[model samples]
Target: MLVTGGLGFVGSHVCVALAEAGYDIVALDNLANARLSVLARLREIAGRRISFVRADVRDGRALAQVFRRRPVAAVLHFAGLKAVHESVAQPLEYYDTNVGGTLTLLRAMRQHDVRRLVFSSSCTVYGAPESLPLTETHPLRPANPYGRTKMIAEGLIADCAAAWPELKYALLRYFNPVGAHPSGRIGEDPLGVPNNLFPYIAQVAVGRRAKLNVWGGDYDTQDGTGVRDYIHVMDLAAGHVAALARLESQPESFTVNLGTGRGYSVLEVVKTFERVCGRPIPYEIRERRAGDLAQSWADATLAERLLGWRARYGLEDMCRDAWRWQSLNPDGYPERPVSAAETRRRRSRRRS
Candidate 1:
């Protein structure tokens, strides 16, 4: 198995799942938004070294080299720019990385005669929901560049599958993925400010941030704040394993939503984290983020039926596991090594 962006939050968790499933894994990452330190943690938890290739998926040569070096049964593509607001500001970069990287990876798979792919897709492709509890049949109406890129990549995969009848693929559309691995050894560690609510709350609980920003307190939800279906990262990782298993067994291609069929308001999540950590999470209600939905969950029945997969962890578990990770890793991942001169400069400033 070859996993692109294998060092990232979701990718790293899925790597653990893949390893436990007895797959010989080669993790390909550019460290664009991930840490090389994660490889050590993965090894610690997985009980073996996972092969790694530090190369961008968008680089055709690097991808081709990976395929040529060894035999890959399938490819799990997770490399891409994921921030919605960042995508809005730099649509070209998103297109270049997300769409272009998928295209490059597919080409490499084709060249290598690798026929299976499990793609990392997002529910943002559904846009503002016309209905609650979105199903696989929900219309593709992406509201932002990040979502559009994913939608486009999904199309590309479908089109490739149509052209190559031998190809089998799984497009996993995820809602908000939260929490950490149960061990808390490996978990979501965003580089800067977190783009998702769960990590932001955890950061505040850990004193990494001053307070939580609860966007939109005037919505039509239970708490008048945004509500989303938050699934544990472990469950989401298991979904990937299930999808890969199905693709290996079946010839047909499919798409499914990986989420709990429920929603939690922002205030609810903050309170839950506070209770778990035994710390008060200070928060402020701000203007609703543009393109923010009042509420959206998932109808994950298809996943349960098709892949025999259902989310096991609920909101409390999500918060508990996330707090474990956050409390343990108060500074998130460790920083990259700095120059000796830079270290001395820091010490000199302290002395002065």
Candidate 2:
């Protein structure tokens, strides 16, 4: 198996699950929003070596060389810019990296004769969802550039599958992925300010930030805050493994939603985190975010039926496990220290 963005938050967890399932992995990542130290942490957690390549998914030549060096049974596509607000600011980068990158990867897979792919998609495809408990057959209408890229990528996969009848693909549309590896070794460590709720809250609890700003509290939900389906990171990882198994066994393309089928409001999450961490999470209600939906959960019946997978962790579990990782690594991961020679060279330049 090959995992793009394997060094990232969800991808790393998926790699751990794949390792536990007895699969040798070749992970390729650009490390744009990740660190090399995670490779060591993943090795520690997997108890096995994972061959890694430091390259971007958009580099087709690099991907082809990777395929030539070793035969890959499947490709787990997880690389792309994921921040919604950031996407709103820079749509072109998102399209090039997310959509164009997938195109490059698809071409490489074709050249290498690899037929299996497990795509990491989002529930954002069902933007401004009309109803609660979103189903797999829900309409396709994304609200942001980040989500639009995913939707376009999904379409490309579908088109490729249509042309190549023998190809098998699994489009796993999941909800909000929270929490971390129970070991607390590898977790969500976004660069700069986080664009998600849990990370912001976790950082505040860890004293890295002063307070968390609740996105919207005027919504028509309990506590008047937005509601979302927050699934544990491990559960999301396990869902990917299950989807891969199904793709390997079945020779057809399919789509499924990975979520707990339950919704939690912003205030509920804060209260839960407060109880779990034994600290007050200072938050203030603010205007709604631009691309946010008031309430969006999942009808994960399709996932359960297709892959025999359903989220096993709930709200409290997510809060507790997330706090564990945040508390352990208040400052996400340490950057490599500068070498003495390099430091001296910089100092010499400054003096000159």
Candidate 3:
């Protein structure tokens, strides 16, 4: 198995799952948004050493070299810029890395005759859902540049599969992935300020940041805040393994949604985190942001039918595991000794 972006949050977790299932892993990552130390953590978690390739998917020659050196069975493509807000600011970069990078990887795969792939797609491809509980058949009208790139990449994969009947692909459209490994050794680590809700809230709860800014609070939802389907990262990782297993026997192309089929509002998440962390998370309601949806979840029945998988973790587990990682490593990987005053500040802010 060749897992791109293996040092990242989702990729690392998927590596652990794949390794545990006795698959040999050859991971390639650019280290632009991830840390090399994550590979060490994965090795520790998987109880085996994994082959590491420090290269980007956009580098065609490097990708070709990897395929020539190793007899890889399948590729799990996870390398891409994911921040929605940042993509809006840097549309070209998003397209270059997400779409162009995939094109490069696909070309290399085609050259090597390694046609099996499990793509990491997003529910964002659905944009603002026309109806609740989005299904795999939902129209894909991506709102942001990031989502648009994913949609286009999915299209490319579909076309490639159509052109070559031998090519098999599984497009796993993921919901909002949260939580960390229960061991707290591996987790999500955004380079700069986090754009996602869970990490931002974890930072506030851990005192890395001040108050959590509920992005859009006036939405027509239960708490007037945007609602999303938050699936545990580990569960999402397992879904990938299932997708691969299903692909092995069927050898057919498919698309499925990996989610809990339940939605949680921003305020509900804050309350859950407060209860789990035993501290108050001070947050204020702000204006609804453009392109923000009131609510979005998934119809995960397709995944269950196709991959024999369904999300088991609930919102509390997501919060508890996330807090474990945040509280343990106030500063993420490359664990630095934080001063007592800084730790106290984080704790004190929760009281405010």
> Which residue runs of candidate 3 sit more than 4 Å off their true CA positions?
335-352
Separate clash counts for every candidate = 0, 0, 0
Candidate 3 local distance difference test against the native:
0.91
- How large is the C-alpha RMSD of every model relative to the true structure? 4.7, 3.9, 7.6
Worst 10 residues of 2 by lDDT: 335-344
TM-score to true structure, per model: 0.95, 0.95, 0.94
* Per-residue accuracy of model 1 over 28-139 as CA lDDT, tens digit each: 9988788778899999999877998878898889988999989999999999999999999999999999999999999989988999999999999999998878999989
On lDDT, the stronger of 1 and 2 is 1
Which regions of candidate 2 deviate over 4 angstroms?
336-352
**lDDT (CA) per prediction:** 0.91, 0.91, 0.91
Candidate 1 error regions (>4 Å): 337-352
What is the TM-score of candidate 1?
Answer: 0.95
Q: Per-residue CA lDDT of candidate 2, range 208-279, in tens?
A: 999888888888998899899999999999998898888878777899999999999999999999999999
